[model samples]
Target: MIQDNIDTTTRQPIYPLLAAFAASCLLGTLATDIVYWWTADIIWADFSDWLVSAGVIVGWVTVIVALIEIFALRSARFRQRSRAYASAMVLALIVIALILATIDMLVHTRDAWTSVVPWGVILSAAVAALVLVTAYLSRITDAPAAIEVTG
Candidate 1:
């Protein structure tokens, strides 16, 4: 049978996971904006910065989760799975980088928009990439490898 001949338990594709993550980020952005807008009047102190930082933390958390999935949960023998997870992580980092870059750009010019490169984003991407590279070099858990090995 086809089912018997081919591997049935296939690893999930990374793009959809990324899409879902992006959606979550967008929703989160909106939610945070709304929440802060609603509370802008009553909240003590400017906690918007804290909330923005929280977004960054959430993104990093995604990276950790993906790394765990690749290293701890999946079998090391399946390099494909590991690679997939790694790729997922990389994509996630890229998304986060874009977000930060956008934020930087927006911040640079409050009234007008600019397409300046986000040094912070680049630094973060580099760090994230290095993490994955180090982990790969170290051969940490052999296999979603999504949560960014990069984050």
Candidate 2:
């Protein structure tokens, strides 16, 4: 019995988890903005503010980890699993989301009603859309690679 070239190096799952969490928070912020718009409540605005802040922070962490993975610890298996173009697109989308979320966080600092009524809500929606697209691209990029064993 012979053992072949089986690479057992497993990549950390923290980046993807953080990415998803950040996306969830950002998307939830959009929902809160909608609720605030419908109800004209200050509490909903506060929720949106906190959510966007958290999302931006977590998104930064996700981006840092992704950058490290891309430049520092890119294993052959990871390269095999991901298409270079798709991975680049995912990173680009995440960065775009981060920028939008940062802007949204600043917008949240305005008066409660005015904060989330228009610009805040619009930024939230844009960030949410970017994160959703990032998540989709990440999923496709992480699909298991087809192993071709030749003798």
Candidate 3:
């Protein structure tokens, strides 16, 4: 008797993912604008400043990595499956960075809610969470390879 099993390997909707990522990037930019509008301060006066800097850095990194993943997906030279996996991994890294940055910001800005809360931290956190969820979905869809077949 012959039996057939379902093929679990399936590609995700890259366009939606890309769109979401783009939206997040735009939101991050808007958050920066909001922060500038609320808090005129630029220098690192305390831990809050550092946290803001870290958040900015993470946002930038996430944007860059997301773009790279998009490019990888569009590349014709590489296998689609491999590209998907690589993209997922990069996205995961971006999410991790965003989470760390958010935690740092929340911890440092807890005392100055009146000042920092209006400065775009909430918007930034929302964007970060969106990126994180998408990244996690990508990771789940593209599981790591178990073995390497060398020629």
Q: For this target, which candidate reaches the highest TM-score against the unseen true structure?
A: 2
Error of 2 at 106 (Å): 0.2
Q: Which tens-of-lDDT digit does each residue in 1-151 have in candidate 1?
A: 5653243245442533533453344334434334444454323112333333444555555555544645565533445655665555555554555465346334423321111123323333343444345336334533333222221
Off by over 4 Å in 1: 1-23, 26-51, 75-78, 81-92, 95-151
How many residue pairs collide in each prediction? 9, 0, 0
lDDT scores for all predictions? 0.41, 0.76, 0.47
lDDT of 2 by residue, 2-26 (tens): 3333322233435766777888899
Which scores better on lDDT, 1 or 3? 3
Task: Give per-residue CA lDDT, model 3, range 1-151, as digits (tens).
Answer: 1221121123332344344444355345445535544665543224344545545564655466445544544433234577557655755655555665555455445444433445445555555566566556555554222111111
- The CA-based lDDT of model 3 is what? 0.47
The TM-score that candidate 3 achieves is 0.34
Q: What is the TM-score of each candidate against the true structure?
A: 0.33, 0.83, 0.34
Give residue 82's lDDT in candidate 2 (0 to 100): 44
